[model samples]
Target: MNYEFLRCDIENKVATVTISHSPGNKLNTQVYQEITQIMGELEANEHVNAIVITGEGEEAFVAGADINELADLDTVGMMDLTQITRTSYSKIENLNKPVIASINGEARGGGLELALSCDLRIASEYAQFAFPEINLGVIPGGGGTQRIQKVVGQGTAKELLYFGETIDAERAYQLQIVNKVVDQNELSSTAKEWARKLAQKAPVALRMMKLAVNTGANVDLESALTIEATSYDGSFATQDRKEGIAARLENRKPNFKGR
Candidate 1:
């Protein structure tokens, strides 16, 4: 389906969703709604193994929410928005397939938070990031508070959020906020390369791996271990597991059906 605020291209087992609203691609209410719908559609497609999210141009991934909308929002409006953003982002985070944020340009405020919700983030050398809510007399009301902390630790997350500062791609890499940094020209290529590799693996095992990391990171040691143990055993119970072993013995690559 065609979208007014986004561009979607599905090739092989990967779907690339590009936020395409303008020179800066600011995320508006319509954009947010459509993005959630597009992701929902992708999630239901068995042929889609991975998703890459990026912006349309090199200027900015998303400059943040449309300033006009944010200015007019009352307390009730804010609460409603919080629910929408939280639910949409959580759905993306909990999706069975992996999602990668291809940070091709500036990812400020909500944009950065959206990228943070993804399983992995890879940035172009020219990409920049910031949580500038403080600049507007507000703080990140999105999952930025919790998710950013997990990706970059409490200290850096606090400093960045408090200062409302922008960091270059290199600095983000040093902080481990992004998994990898590559040349601007190679950003999309690198993301697709990673997605392609992930698509070749057993889908069930990948889902379990994602579950182990996401759920295990939030609990006590005993609970985390319990989650990890279940994930390990769950992967072993898949039909693909037996195929993998048998294929190894037969000197062939296993064909996984996501069973």
Candidate 2:
């Protein structure tokens, strides 16, 4: 399918979605709509097992939202925009297949929020992260406040959001926001490597694992354990489980059909 704001390329069971708005790749209403639609398509595409998200240029992963688009909005319009943004980001976070953010450069405001929605983040050495919404007299509305706190803890999340200060990739790694940091030249290849590795795993098991972790994160310990156990038990019924065991005994590589 054609997209106005992004490009989706699939290879070796990995789908890479590039935000192609150019320059800063700032998110506007069209970007949000395209993201939502593309994510849904990727989720339903049987051949896709992993997904990667990144921006088009060298200067920014995504600089922020389209400030020009936001500048003319009334209160109701702002609410509508935030709702769409939140829904789009939520789709990324809850995708059955794993999603990785290959953050190449600056990620500020809604851009940082978008990265936070991914299952994992791999940032380039030149990448920077911030929630600069406060500068515009607003706060993050696209799950940033909640997701960042979950990843980096409350105090650090508060500091980043309140002060609207940008942190380098190293600092973000230290804060546990990004899973890994590499040179800018290696960012795309590294992200693809990880995504391909993920694609080679048992799809059903990975889906259950992701489901368990995402769902359990919000519940009590006992409830979380119950959810995990349920997911674990459900995995045993898949054909992939039998193939995995048979391959182990035969000393051959397992062929997973995502069944």
Candidate 3:
């Protein structure tokens, strides 16, 4: 599908999605709709084993939501907008393939929330992060409150959300919000490298592992264990699992057909 607010490219089973709504990449309802469609396409594309999301330019991954659009939103409109964005974010979170947020620059408010939904985040040295919705007389509406706490601690999430404070890449790395912080020049290469590595893994195992972790996170320990066991058992039935075992025995690389 043609997209005005986003650009997508796929190579070697890795799909890179770049938000280009504006220089700051501030998201709006239209962007969320586009994201939902893009995600659906990626999910159906068997060749796409991993995904990477980032901003178009170096100035900002996404500064926040478009204030102009927010200014016009009434209570009902806000709720609708929130639902749309939340659904889009949830799609990224629940995708069987791993989604990596390549934070090329500042990611604040909704921008930060988008990154939080990803399975992993790799930020550049120049990148910054914040949950500044409080300053706007609103709070994060796109699963940020939950995901951030999962990535960082509850205390840290509260402090950041309550104060609307911004942190640089170093502090974000220390807080465990980002998986890696690299020089700006290396940001794209690093993110792609990670995606490519994931793409080469046993596809069925990758999907099942993601399902186990995400589905188990909200359940009791015993239930979570059961979920993992179920996923593990299902993986054993895949042809890739047999190939993986055979390759290990032969000391050769496995060519998983994503079965």
Best by lDDT: 2
Pairs of residues at least 3 apart in sequence or in different chains that clash in candidate 2: none
Candidate 3, residues 1-259: lDDT per residue as tens digits?
8899999999999999999977599999999999999999999899999999999989999999999998999999999998999899999999989999999998999899999989999999999999998988888999889989988889999999999999999999999999999999999999999999999999889999999999999999999999999999999999999999999999999999999
lDDT of 1 by residue, 160-182 (tens): 99999999999999998899999
Model 2, span 82-182: residue lDDT tens:
99999999999999999999999999988999999999999999999999989889899999999999998999899999999989999999999999999
Give RMSD to native, each candidate: 1.2, 0.7, 0.7
The C-alpha stretches of model 2 lying farther than 4 A from their native spots are none
Candidate 3: deviation at residue 182, Å?
A: 0.3
Give all candidates' CA lDDT scores: 0.89, 0.95, 0.94
Kindly report the root-mean-square deviation of model 1 from the true structure over all alpha carbons. 1.2
Global lDDT of model 1: 0.89
Off by over 4 Å in 3: none
Superposed by TM-score, candidate 1 places the C-alpha of residue 58 at a distance from the truth, in angstroms, of 1.0
Residue-level error in angstroms, candidate 3, position 157: 0.8
Q: What is the TM-score of each candidate against the true structure?
A: 0.96, 0.99, 0.99
Task: Please report how far candidate 2 places residue 200 from its true position, in Å.
Answer: 0.6
| Candidate 1 TM-score to native | 0.96
